[model samples]
Target: MQEFAFELALCAHLERPDRVVGRQLGAAVHGRRVADVCLVEPGPEFDRRAAVTPHTIPPLAIESDAGPGTARPVAEAFDCHPDRARAVAERAVELGFFEREREGASTAVRQTVRYPEQWFDSLVGIENKPDLDRPGDLRDQLRIDASLGLFDEVVLATETYVTGAHLNRLPDAVGVWRFDPETGEREVVREPEPLATDGPGIELLDREPGRAEVRPVTAAEKRRQRRRIAERAYGKGWRTYELPDCERCAPSDAEPADLADARLPWCAWTDGLVRPVADCGPTCPGYEPVDGGDSDGDAEGVPPSEGPEAVRARRSAWEPDPAGVDRRQAGLDRFL
Candidate 1:
């Protein structure tokens, strides 16, 4: 629960008009290495990408041979099985990334717009430990991240007072930041060195007492994985939780003055942020039912308004509803 509160506070602080912030994203190319936070800096074609769809454009659709100029049969465009290709195409069309056309008996699809390859500039992966005193596999995680070089920069965010010994334990390329979840203040303990994102990288797969297993990742694979990460971050922002049905939940006053609008799960009874899934329920003494039942304290229910979607749309570069470009024409001869 400490880590959850810290992560939400950090995400609120990191969100801005120029960048998109997401949490708990898969960052590893081979092994399972989930990043606590992913900051996506926008590129020149950011607006174009946003205009396409509010949801993620399936990676398979982007990698297929479909183009805006020519309509290709779904089976011919995708290398996967016919059913999977059709399903992926249908999803892409639903997301406004692809348009369908009737080509004789078979269905053909074409991209509504060219995939914006430069929509995102860079990705920064952050690992949160909050308490360095209980450092569990922190060194191994940082080492894996550095060797993979998937992200342009990697940093460790914590509330612990980092010592010189802690600095020595971390990789040189990994940076450190001291973050205060209560005050919303951050201090950079060390700046991160840039990784070789353009070149090949080594992925640390497994390590035993005597032997270590690794995989050599090519530059092309890294590029594809980077795009997948960006797409996921764009679709899934950091506010992935819902406010519990408790009268004590007050978002307006829970966060700091600057972050009050974030709509975090702040519990008035506890006088601190609370994880609704874990900290909230009938078992909690402060959990007054939202339906206006008997309560120990004077209870006023949570106010009604638009949910986190509206908050995210107002705060970040994401578009909740975009004017899509999936309009289809009546003729197949034009596509041919």
Candidate 2:
């Protein structure tokens, strides 16, 4: 089953490769499930809180074979069967993750609430932005539980799966956006760091109580860490798939690669802008994805692709984009 594919790819999908935009990847396990991972430049970052709230539960709530505390605890609250452990554990993780994120958001909101009226008056930036006072190298101690892709990495269970984006209006502010499956809309969330801490280092220093300055993570550092985690996860061989739609490559086009290119828009793939997946859908034309590179299955039992060559056309091979499209779109569309 590609059951373990998405779980493993969770990390990599979050931290896509470097300068590897405008590419789509589908990978799988045992030819069952897969994950559809795209790298693209999206629109401005909106208030995720303002966006539609995700109805689909996250994976962090499940009970694991490991223990009670973890997302996947050993046996359920009851002594459930071990065979059913994985499924149960996985579900728990998803839900627990949603809750954990909610709790963190709540905490951040509380901290923000404590800001005095005068503080808010002069607040060009968050004076003491959503601060997290963990007692260790938080960046190093991310809880990467039930590791499917890579090991020894920090795991973040935000309410939404990120699309790795930037806020156009606020060029300096980077956004990690996602199309929340539950809400059926886009949402953007904050990464580890943004504002500088009022104190020095991980160690705390005396500062205004309510006016504390939570240190935000650096953009470069944030990108680097995310890339590392994603690389480690993609290193695994589970399957991966996409929800559908790539705005640029045109999923509705008569071609396959353009539809799935990460550099494109989500609609290009899912919205029928490009040709549909030949093998899976109805009215089957029945052609294989010649360029369907490195596939890894997700919960939906699809696979991922590999490398830029998947979308490129060769003299002897059929170009994934059948309209005799621009070769530059295959690579340069990422700027969009």
Per-candidate TM-scores read: 0.92, 0.21
Q: Which lDDT tens digits does candidate 2 get at residues 14-97?
A: 333221221122211111111223222112221121121212211121111232122222333324565554454444343232
Compose the digit string of candidate 1's lDDT tens values, residues 41-130. Answer: 999999999999888899999999998777899989999999999999999998989999877999999998889999999999999999
**Top lDDT: which candidate number?**
1
lDDT of each: 0.87, 0.24
TM-score of 2: 0.21
lDDT value for model 1:
0.87
TM-score, structure 1 vs. true: 0.92
Model 1: ten consecutive residues of lowest lDDT: 294-303
